[model samples]
Target: MRNLLVFCVLFSFIFFNSCGEPSKKKEENQLEEISENDNQEKSESGVILFFGNSLTAGMGLDPNEAFPAVIQQKIDSLGLPYEVVNAGLSGETTAAGKNRISWVLSQDVSVFVLELGANDGLRGVPLEETRKNLQEIINTVREKNPDTKIILAGMQIPPNMGQEYTSEFRNIFPELAEKNDVHLISFLLEDVAGNPELNQGDGIHPTAEGQKILAKNVWEVLGPVISE
Candidate 1:
């Protein structure tokens, strides 16, 4: 009787363990299928690759209210059809952006907006390094597709960084734009930067209204590209 009870317990344990595999496998398969479906949806719609840091990530605001979202809304309202593929990773530096350039450009991108380098500025990384990373990304994308519309969103360092350093950082954008002959938005947060109402508590990221202004800023530069 003791032997039989031990045998039964062992059998139950083995049976339950074996049975769990199918359930686990089923869940994994379902998740994979869902992911594939989402990818298909994104690909079919059309793609706008947005590579940047927190500003592009829509930090402190809903995804729908982010600059990308605002751009999508404008696209929709104007009957300009395209998908906004937001690849903005908050806290990413230009080096990180450089690392991911190939992968982002590999996609079916109608337009590419490069909004990185802010974190690099904030961290006081070498301006040359920031410029090189951005330049490499721009060059690589152009190599992949010569006609690809590239928008370089410029950023300004805080005044506390000292006028000399800040001036050098500020000049990076126009210098690159002039060299590359690509479209430039000048400053990503032009009208809202110092405005307390347009920015969040951090005074860095934009509020919802600020995002609208930003989207408008980008559109003023990017609108003609898509329109043409």
Candidate 2:
């Protein structure tokens, strides 16, 4: 009888241990599944890169106050899966932008917004040079990924440089947009450009209010493209 009781106890212990092992293994498998799903979601998120000068950078304002950040807010509201990257640098000419295009293209870009040439125009760079650099940048982006959508932000400098030069500068954007078949943001600073209230004291960078308009302008073009 004592031996029989011992046998029964050993059987119970083995049964419980086997049951517990499967439960623990099931829990670990569930955790691994959750981890894989999280990684898949992150990898699926697309990147929208806004590459340009201080206008894109929001030079004088808080980083979040930049137009790209504002656009991010809009995107979140719409439940979009794309991420916005502000690659704007202060005083970035088309040449500087060309130099860094490769580095910036390191990340997979679903959409590429080009906002350079403003600094170049302001500084009186030759139109041909500006056009060539812009084309090269566009080419680099295409070479990296032909699927990337390109948007050219049209910029206009005051006629401080003769009207002929200013007109040609303005024309360059449309021409590039046409030649490369990229979308164009007619003017990055439409309603805010000459508005004293919208711009900062420098009359160049937009104030917070000005940034709102810029965001609106971009959305006009961006909304349609993304929707497609």
Candidate 3:
């Protein structure tokens, strides 16, 4: 009779443990699933992406001084529900921007600011190629997020590139904006460009002060879109 009792207790212990093991594993799996969903939800939230070159990168200044960061500050103050992602890379050309656009678009984007082609124009890259690359970049962004609001930052190259080339380069931004039906910032550097106080020693990238102006330029158009 003792042997029978011992067998029954051992069976009960084994059965309970076996049942508990699956329950523990299921709880762990559920927690893991919940974490993944939370991460995905966070990523899908509204994102304002600034994809461009050195000017956008804030080369000579701190990252926080970058126009995109400045824009973020404005967004925060307004209590807007958007995050800014500065994907700027120094010396980035239209072709390079186009090439890496897919990777940038992988994340959810509510607003996309395109600030490219300046380097391409400076390098004397073919106008047709530059236009084509810019167009493709716009197309890819639209394809990735059909509802994303696109803002094109127009840039001007030095006159040394010759009157005709410079004119054509200057015209690209507006042309592309018109074709794509996107908002355009006529001149990104407006009051900042050519001003030694606003630019770095290199006379190219903007200084911290210059970036503030740039941010305002972006915000003028961006604010309306986000408010909507």
Candidate 4:
């Protein structure tokens, strides 16, 4: 009787341990599977983030009407495998953009379109400061994702700021693009700027019609980059 009791106890202990081991392993495998699924989703849904000020935000227009949204439509139409995230903030300056860039780059960005410095120029922030801020932004993006394709949008301030400052500001984008070996959009506003019909009442933000032109301007450079 004593031997039979000891044998029964040992059998129970072995049975429980054997069951527990597989359960623990199964739970571990499930957790690993979930982690892999999350990574796959992130990889498949890589984003093309448009980070900038009011122009990128599409101020005074419906959220869908923004140039970034317009670009999203275009991307969808073409059946591209990327999502567009409009990270534009109205009235944002270069200094503000520099401060926020690190947080903005936390996501996985396949393509980064930077449209800033217009507010800095309008506010008459130091030209050198603007250039530095822009360079830092590019650097931060590169650090986050070396493979991310960058497109720098050029901006121009009104002559009221002075020719020297405007010229320097205008040169900042191309110089940064060439220095960093990134794509450059010669002028963000292009045909929209100085056109009363294309601008909002403030003569700064683009009208809906103007947003289309802005979309076209971005698409010209962006389309080829994404295609490659």
Candidate 5:
């Protein structure tokens, strides 16, 4: 049935990314733990958590190639006082993200970029459910830290799911951003999507060159927020 098919798709998507997991710790995580002696060194970095799915995790590519890592490199170049944590799960839906968000927010976050719901849209998950789950995630972030700046990455899917469904899915990101009063990325994929050269053989995840574009897209909105 449809439920089984959805599960299969999710599993396959996750499996594809699982192949690249050994390098995640080395490339995606940038938390700094200064020793007491080093505490005098100064510069306590706040965390910038990038929470989402495969795209955020940089599936099919090196973790360093992911946009979040790219953002971290940018932050380092400018000497920003923030660490970037890539919490992207390949098969994550908004509902799945909600279940794990509390633990993820255990550390204080200066900026949170949310990039989920693409899997939901692809699997034809109910639009209302997707919207509600995303709202909950946003709410959880605010509750965890009232001062944490949020950036919601917008996602869009093809019309294979019908015009109404596709349109509703596309609108979820901006509507939630407006309703929650947070920064919005407009379209996370932007120029990267639907471009054959920019994507992998799967024609979904972006290539290394494409990730550079993704980094640019995120920096456009993120640069100002972190700089502010």
Candidate 6:
């Protein structure tokens, strides 16, 4: 009878231990999955905010086909992990971009590509106002994110707008870039600005091929800052 009780007790011990092993393993697996997810979130590279208007919206082209997208592809191909946020709103002026600058800067961005002033120039907005708004945007970004890199993409007004006004608008970007000690991506439309073949029918937006070149133009300046 004592031997029989001993045998029963041993059987119960073995059964409970066997049952507890799988449960412990399941908890460990759950903990591992949570840990992996947290690690991935922490490993993600910083954000790139492209703030501008239709030229930025890639009007007449797919959003994913925009120059920003091209830059993203280049970054990926080079195996640099980063996120590109297209904050382009069609027909948005520098004033409008300024209005939203605070909200946009709320994101944890590593870089900013300021591509406004085009719509302001197109609409004949006062060059001083454009300069002021852009300067404020730059100053705000710098103040909020001291380490964020900025690339000022320049824009030119059409000749019909009179050379004085045109030159003032064009010079805003470089001047601000210099004042802030940031990089300047001269002429967002470098290869595609005046070329009919490169521009879409609107003569403002770029063709698909043109967008690719524009992306490269911005990348030339941006790549270096981000690469480092």
Best by lDDT: 2
lDDT of 6 at 189: 92
The C-alpha RMSD of each candidate to the native structure, in angstroms, is: 11.7, 9.3, 9.7, 10.4, 17.2, 9.4
As for lDDT, the candidate ahead, 5 or 6, is 5
Per-candidate TM-scores read 0.79, 0.89, 0.82, 0.82, 0.83, 0.86
Pairs that collide in candidate 1 are none
| lDDT by candidate, in order shown | 0.84, 0.91, 0.89, 0.89, 0.88, 0.85
Q: Which lDDT value does model 1 have at 81?
A: 64
Counting clashing residue pairs in each candidate, in order, gives 0, 0, 0, 0, 0, 0
**CA deviation > 4 Å runs, candidate 4:** 1-42
Q: By the lDDT metric, which is better: model 1 or model 6?
A: 6
Local accuracy of candidate 5 as per-residue lDDT tens digits, 50-107: 9999999999999999999998899999988888999999989999999999999998
**Residue-wise lDDT of candidate 3 within 43-157, one digit each (tens)?**
7569999999998999978999999999999988988878999999999999999989999888878999999988998889999999999999999998988999999999998
Top candidate on TM-score is: 2
Model 2 pairs whose backbones collide: none
Residue-pair clash count for candidate 1: 0
lDDT score, candidate 6, position 193 = 84
Ranking of all predicted structures according to lDDT, beginning with the best and ending with the worst: 2, 4, 3, 5, 6, 1
- The clash tally of candidate 4 reads 0
lDDT of 2 by residue, 98-216 (tens): 99999999999999999999989889999999999999999999999999999999988899999999999999999999999999999998999889999999988999999989999
* Candidate 5 local Cα displacement, residue 226, angstroms: 0.8
Clashes of 3: 0
Q: Is candidate 1 or 3 superior in TM-score?
A: 3
* C-alpha lDDT (0 to 100) for residue 161 of candidate 1: 76
